[model samples]
Target: MRGADCASDHELVRAKIKISLKANYKSNKKHRKFNTNKLRDSSITNKYQQTLERHVGNLEQVGKSSIEGIWEIYKNAYMKAGKEILGCKEKADRPWITLDTKTKIKERRAIKTELIKTRNPIKRKEI
Candidate 1:
């Protein structure tokens, strides 16, 4: 695996490209959960609907020449209004695990451990 031979005070060296296949592990992307329940609040819901109506009403052909342009205009206005009126909910990086669920998991693990240690039919049945 020899690189290019170069001799100079300031040398530019070239090396063979190493092609390798690596696992493309996806980052844990939490699904965005919009608080659509905000729509249940009368005031917020009304504001959102009004803002969206205004935005849509104001929308005109963006590119003027292409159908995609007009659609894009509508899409942008819709998204912008939704963002302004019903702002996206901030999500925690990790999903919340309730303390009750945590306690239940701990109990299950302890039971499994006890069943393994004793090899008792009763413990196995309990587990």
Candidate 2:
């Protein structure tokens, strides 16, 4: 077998094997990301605080509740308040490569293919 483009005394080895890979599936659940930028506004902040306080006050009457139960009340209150006041942020799917980047990548690939076609080392270097 032929080695790679790098300068090395090592020869490439070929192997034949059967390998099975499991297909990975993405989850259907949407991520809960609150619009924290809304919190910067004084009015929004005040509303969130008021809503959270009201929810917490209402849930605080669980008699002889465990520490975990109390923590759950606090968590649920905050989540509900944030969801009502701030709301979840929308997911923006932007392209991974820009137009300029794609053009540059095409230019590089063309140059590489030209270099590969050249038999002379000097011509490859010039390319």
lDDT of each candidate versus the true structure: 0.68, 0.82
- Candidate 1 CA-lDDT value: 0.68
lDDT for 65 in candidate 1 is: 40
Q: Model 2: per-residue lDDT, tens digit, 57-114? A: 8544855689898889888898899889999998999999799988887777677668
lDDT of 1 by residue, 26-98 (tens): 8896554456778899998888878877776643434454887677767767777767877778866865888
The RMSD of every model to the true structure, in order and in angstroms, is 17.1, 4.9
> In candidate 1, how many Å is residue 52 off?
1.1
User: What are the clash counts of all predictions, listed in order?
Assistant: 0, 0
Inter-residue clash pairs, candidate 2: none
TM-score quality measure for candidate 1: 0.42
C-alpha RMSD between model 1 and the true structure: 17.1
Question: What TM-score would every model get versus the actual structure?
Answer: 0.42, 0.65
